[model samples]
Target: MSELASGVQVVRGEMQPWSDQATPHPALAALLTDVVPANRRTLILGPHAPQQIESVLAHSADVTILVRSVADAQQLGEDFGPCLQVIAGALDGLQGEPYDVIIATDGLDRVLGYDSSDLSWTERLGALAGLAAPDAVVVLALENEFSLLNLLDSRPADERHGDDEWRPLHDDPTRPVSVDQLKAALPWRAEVYADFGSRTFVRADVAAAARPGELPTRLATAALESVDVPLLSPAAEGVDSACRAGLLGSIPTGWVAIAGAGATRDVYTQTGEAVLTADQNLTGWDVTITGDATPAFDPAVVPTTVPSGVSVETVLFRLAAAEDVPAFRKLAADLGEWATTSRVILRWDDVIFDGESFAYGVSPWVTEEPVDKEDLLAAAWSRFQDRLIGQHRRHPWPPWMLGDDLVSAWLGMSGIEPPEQLQATSPDTAPAAAVQVARGKELAAALGVLLETRTDTVDVRTALAEAEEAKQELFELKGHVYGLERTLGFRNKAMKTRENRIRELRGQLQRLTTAHERIRGSRTYAVSRVIFHAAQVRKPKTVARKVARRIRKR
Candidate 1:
């Protein structure tokens, strides 16, 4: 290994300008801690999360990480001190002693760099296996191109490519497509996980998941919930359908293969400090909880028997999808009566029914406080209502009925009194009401995200018609503006005419006043004014004498 100035060694090949990094997952790290052996030569290939590297370091002192991006190598070198040997090169060029523990949990796609030759999946797998020792524990995660997540993704092929995928070998005919094929391709006995990077991991080919109400089915459903981008359809529905078809293992988000021992658990599902496990019995499964956790419903009410039969959620989904209003109504009524009488908070997906009665599934969530009968019933139906609308599932009810109204209709059909249209005034219902309000806000935000996935393209003719209508509107607007301008011009002309007429009238009045003043100031006009004054003062004779005297003076 030739050490470079940047503190990372260049094993072989040239370093490229790649900057993509994998996200850290705590659950995946924990699983690695269990599978990766201690005090052995380990090689971590590709860009793995720092948490994963840290987990491996906790078990083993000598660890080497290979990454194509020089920046990634520098960062890993800085983050993990001198103990970790960071190599900056392509996977094919790296020559080293065989590793007893080989981890490529981020998969083989990112192992190639910009200057590397395009290698097929089978070639990459062979190269990876060749790097491993005879008794090495190889932990590899392979992404399924035809996973439910990929199948339900609304993004087109052209839009799905990222910069890190310089040349994606997706159409490799020799690569293993399914878990069964992947297991067969492995050289050693391997345990493959279905949901590898998720919060839960399950054995890919667990036969119990084929049944609808089995523990693996619930685990798969919960694990497959969309935490990232919105899917074209509900992942829960896909899981249920796949389970019924005995193909749940065929389309996992990804497969994690642990070859050559060290895997102790078939399923590893944990939330906070709580961990859930299942042991298969003759009939079904016996679930055991390790840590202290509360059920979503009241924990005080525990079922004496194990949960069996299909989930209420699945039944409701089928009825709504089939538009079987009667069956749905009956189920709603049964659920409402049971919840109201029990006065327990319940989630539809966590409750199972074996035809005779309902039992709580192995959900360990808890409500903040106990709720009223109406609140309990409303919450359950409201959750169902959200999934129905959020997933765009078809139902017999009118599309117009939505939100609180649809929830109320379901409650009414359940033979229970619908909740009052008033805020929670009493202190007794305040805590539960607050919880419901917060849940509603969260559900609304989630629903908004789901609705944004709709990629309905505008029809060509429709787009043309809309454009034409907009053009016509623009033409009409321009004409209206022109008419207004004409009217304004006419008004301006009339105003100018009136102004000119007023100026002419002022000129004529000025001329007439000047002529009258000139006539009034004349001497003959003064003499006539004096005569008229004398005639008005005397009688007719006195007026004649005054007129004669005035005439003589003139």
Candidate 2:
């Protein structure tokens, strides 16, 4: 996260010079390139030398760089050589010469590392006041107290480092160094200038901006065009109203306090590139499409005629690391598939890494209706849900503004609308996601009821679906158990019928045996045997043979 503070690396600790801090801020570079006198005494206090410092060193003869870390000083000396004497020492130890120029844009928080410096920012300012040469300039960049960007800040204020020592603002709404405080603390008269987009500061001489409404647009355009980072302007109405009410210069990312010179030298710069002034005096133009914060897409390229005029615009986004490149590749693949098969005729082309940021372009493939706010959101929202969401292999991803949806993001950045932060559910049923989704519902519900507000229909639906899916699974298991119970009941009734049939058969057998036994034992059985004997006696030889056979048988 070692990104540009005043359009240059706010080189704090290690691990960054590898990241966004790879390049110096152009505005700060311009400032140093302009102000650094030839062969004049100068002292730069920092962790590592900024690029502009080296440029200034090339011109100066008596240059001394007092860096915090001994290792950093050695590294800087190795990196920048005999052009400047890199000293590994504390600010208190720096003596023997008064510097003509002292540029400590990165604050005291970085200057005094683990070593506890009892001096506060103002105290440090007073200490710095001791080293300033007559007619010398003291340029210090400090974070603004009333910056709207602070409200939208996603990252924590401090990391491995300590507090932002020279920051005029505090997150706990702690005391900020007032103009009077700075005035009282510094030896020279100080004029604080609003450094917007941190490229240049508004001169105290200018009093107020010629156009205040344009500050928001300027803020966005500055970040995108200058730093190549998408910076959304505040969407708060009160912020804009404040700007309209002569508070445009009041709110800033940071301020440059140029001492030793008063409001006469209020502003200083050799303008690198002027942002938000691309369409300065266009008289009148039709089909004007200004980027609002509610961006439907980002990393998109579009082309259209401004009625009689013609122009093309492109917005590029940088992926944080190499691992994220594949997700964009997958997005391109899905977009291509959607273009070839679906009703949408949008095509994504020219995907390339621009060294700094991932560069990709998108354009409509066919003749279509001119894109409007609603239609753009509608088309993009549909495509995003269908092709994005769970489609990317890297998802559930950190929320990103890609494709044509940057418009929604732009809207939010400009303080005009809100971004559609689509939080995709994780592939596995990680309880974390479920819990977060539940919390979101609870928040949304509470807001809806208590505040009579609405937010994130998509998130609410997603959460509800998650809960219902789990419930439906249980219902299905219950239905299966119910089916088994009905089967067992029928089998039990059949078993009882079988038992009754066995009992009836036993009773029939008993009755039949009783009848046969009674008949065999009856007296009529003796008379029937006598008649049978008389028939046998009718034949004389037969009767004698029968009697002899009976005797032999007996």
TM-scores, all candidates, are 0.69, 0.43
What would the per-residue lDDT of candidate 2 be over residues 92-182, giving only the tens digit for each residue? 5555667888877664544543443455666666667678887887777665555655543433546312332232222422224444444
- Can you tell me which runs of candidate 2 are displaced by over 4 Å? 1-23, 154-185, 197-200, 204-217, 220-239, 260-554
Candidate 1, residue 371: how far the Cα is off, in Å = 3.0
Please write out the lDDT profile of model 1 over residues 201-261, one tens digit for every residue.
7777673356675667776666666246446656766777788898888777788899885
Worst 10 residues of 2 by lDDT: 307-316
lDDT of 2 at 493: 94
Global Cα lDDT for candidate 1: 0.73
